[model samples]
Target: MKLQPSAVGIVVADMAASLAFYRSLGLAVPDEPAPHVEVPFGALRLLLDTEETVASFDPSFTPPTGEGRVGLALECDSPADVDTAYERLVGEGYRGHLAPFDAVWGQRYASVLDPDGVGVDLFAASS
Candidate 1:
């Protein structure tokens, strides 16, 4: 048997809010909403499902109690884009984890919490 990572699924309580955040990042997400949405990204996919949608399929399913279990790092066109994108999301009312800054690891990095409180990192190579 062989296994390869494919899609990253995020269970969101509010699909509308989730879509807005990803769209701001330049993802080609459709305007029409649904309980589950999959945005194609090259060979990979970003999947979003509502909490109610998951619970309907699995009776024992329950949302995590707190934060920091899963995180996603996204690349930007440039360091300035990282700052712009971060501010855009925060301005749109999403929770900003860390204000965009030049990290010691040599990248411009920032974080914003999705509607479900999942960490979605925005970064770019420091220039």
Candidate 2:
């Protein structure tokens, strides 16, 4: 059988923190903690697993170090909305990686870090 893209799984250290981060980004994930939680976004399901969940089967699961090991992006309705989202997240104590700016590529772009220190970008085209 042919293989097609299905899900994106992220092993998180703290379920509550990770869930809060994704929920702030407008994902409909519930504000609950679980060893493994799945959220369906359109066609792809976002799979969240705790450190123990991964290690349960693999036994060799060691969380990778360093920042930006994973990248997630969201597109807003307009350039201004991108700034609003970025500011709101930062205002809530999340780390803002790059302040909102008009990228040379014809889009407003910004970035913020999640609880796991992964960079999540916010971008939108000029309207």
Scored by Cα lDDT, where does model 1 land? 0.88
Per-residue lDDT of 1-127 in model 2, one digit per residue for the tens? 9999999888898999999989988898977798999987668888999989999999778986778788878889999999999999999999999999999999999999988888989999976
lDDT score, candidate 1, position 39: 96
- How many residue pairs of model 1 clash at the backbone? 0
lDDT of 1 by residue, 6-45 (tens): 9988888789988987887788998977999999866789
Pairs that collide in candidate 1 are: none
* Cα error, candidate 2, residue 72 (Å): 0.8
Top candidate by TM-score: 2
State residue 55's C-alpha deviation in candidate 2, in Å: 0.8
Cα deviation of 11, candidate 1, in Å: 0.8
RMSD of 1: 1.3
Scanning candidate 1 in windows of ten residues, the lowest lDDT window is 63-72
What is the C-alpha local distance difference test score of each model? 0.88, 0.90
